[model samples]
Target: MTMQNPVRPLLTPLLAALVLAGCATAPPSLDKALPQTPAAFSEGGVPWTTAAPAEAQARGEWWKAFGDAQLDALVERAERGSTSIQVAAARLAQARAVLGATDANRALQVGLGAGASREAQRGLGVAPNTVLSAGAQLSYELDLFGRLAKASDAAALDVRSREALLRSTRLLVQAQIAQSYFALRALDAEQTLVHGTVEAYRDTLRLTERRYAAGDVAELDLVRVRSEVAATESEALALERQRAQLEHAIALLAGEPASGFRIAADDWRATPPQVPAGVPSTVLARRPDVSAAQSALLAAQARVGVAQAAWFPNLALTASGGFASSELSELFRSSARAWGIGALLSLPLLDGGRREAGVANARAELDAALAGYREQVLVAFKDVEDELAALRLLARQGDAQGQAVDAAARATTLSETRYRNGLVSQLELLDARRSELRNRREALQVRSAQYQSTVRLIRALGGGWGEAA
Candidate 1:
């Protein structure tokens, strides 16, 4: 036992080094923190058998599917100049810089310094002399406890999260622009409908006044006709105001001032693109926001590992070599060389619970990140389901609206024919015309809705399975 004591002392340090190095354990996998995803969406009218293929991905330029060259140009312009996208890009750059800094922490730190100082002796009765020195130093943290590596991994994940967020920002902006553009066109169609009615009312008003002056129709009939014309004009005026506001909004989204931007009265011809209904499981992998949330969770877990490492002892190897002398001429001479090679080991014997607080804080962050990630998943599924329901319901509603438009048109034609022959009262003719106008406007509105819902569904699918993001 006496002979064994000496060898045991030598082996103790080696074993401790191995243990400390082993403390650099990897963070847990994301599956443990993620909530379970549904096998399929609850929304009706989708192809359940179409499991999203592994090769399917989002096309970044989803707006191009609308077949509108103007919209495509606007989206491209916004991609380059939008302030919101610029802000996201700037944040991504910042995250990249932080990652670079963290990675640099793993390398040796070196500095070269030179200084001269004059010293004076008062009571010792000694001569004063200037001290001159020049040297180089280097320090490297050996990552014995894995703190540096953990921190670096966390920073790298942060960069990934920021990058994903950038993509999310672009997707959102493109969707908004499409919705706004379609709405503007719908308004134009409504304006044309209203304007045509105004002209028809003007003709009817002239005929009623002629009848009133000749005593063939009552004065009350003339007043009623005039009132109807005024009300129709008022409706047209309101629609014009709405169109102006919508136009301004589109201009802003296109990254241009309202005063400088204009979209002429082009016919609303953009049709909704047919997007493939992929599997719900594939959607989780496709959404940029969901990816960002997952990355954030990973980064938090890495930070937690770093905090836990604080409890273990730290070890670092250091080496410094330089030449120094009291006289300037001899400062760099070989005879004046000074050198040191050593190792430092630090253990937190007592820290008033500061280290404990750090560990607890890191754990709390991990919990928050986990919750956020699961929430993102839930929201993503909800968005897809909501869009599916809209598309299904809107398709049926548009069909019924088309039938209503046809019926109203027939009624208006028959009523006009009877009024010219004096077979029906003026009020009956007016009622038929009003019904036609309202139904025609409603049909236009439904068409606009179909286009809007289609765009919304595409966005909810995390940019769809066809396009390259």
Candidate 2:
């Protein structure tokens, strides 16, 4: 008669459960947790033309749309040289290595050992004897509960999260460089305008002095013109100071020493890239931050599975084969050969609520990750909406500003002509000139804002490198 193992009945149910756990499921689809989004954005974006073939493939270097070669070179250099990018890359590499190590965990593990020992048995009246031994051991954790597998899956998701975060960091660095570069250019134009105004004021001052000397105008006119020239020159100096600061900021972003870096005065003419008529669904996928959050949530789910796995029994098999002998040379001899194999089954009878606490902690972490992911999605939608509204409103403001500048220019021309014909007072002519300068400067500011907003919107939509339309 065949005899059955006494524990067979008790183990049957656990073995069945372990088999069921092998079919572990991953986290649910992100769609179920995502907040509601509108089909169309509230603000219509800037009128952007369709991209050319070359432009469509430019990727993260969206600054190239501005057609500035210097900016392209700067962004490229930053991508390679910035410490921020380097740090993020290092983290991504570390996550990959961790995942690789975790994957390797789901395999047989072996260890080898050799040892020699001598023992003296004075009480037993035996002579001292020496023994030598050599052995190789093998052990494998039978992942019947899918515990190790779930841990590995969690690690893999972590790698994906890090990868997305790295991409997000790279996009942020590029956007910062573009915005700074554009701002510097705007300041350059402003300085040029200031310099011209200063020179024109100085020339007027000299003419007024001569006219006063010849009794063609009063001393008050010369004093007033001199004051205007002084103030204009002072404004030019301040503008140059601001330009230097912006240049320094750009150099730092490019990972260069500010003292050794300089961006010469250049024109700003970057046309905004086209916002493709894609809906919110695509944007969610393209945004790296959102992707990163989703990966984190998935990782959390995997961890919860790992924790739940602890409730199941653990199974391990271990084996060792070796030889032993009084003489080191005979350690591998057949006469001294020995081998052993064993299996272990562990079940938690009591753990003072540790396992339950672990499950609770894991569940809490999953909840937190889910909440965090939802927050990021909401923030992403808001970011896109905010930028669209800004661009739309800025476009309207720019149009009005342009009209104001044109009117001021016409008013200045008429006032100058009337002053030359002795039909307008010097105060009236000076006020008209200042108004034109102020209006022109304001218009340039509005244009700069438009370029900045365009860059912001591109970043909000996720850099051109991703699935962004």
**C-alpha lDDT score of every prediction, in listed order:** 0.81, 0.82
Clashing pairs in 2: none
List clashing residue pairs in candidate 1. Answer: 58-467, 59-467, 59-468
lDDT per residue, candidate 1, 140-164, as tens digits?
8888667899999999999989988
Candidate 1, 6: how far from true, in Å?
Answer: 15
Off by over 4 Å in 2: 1-30, 45-60, 279-281, 465-468
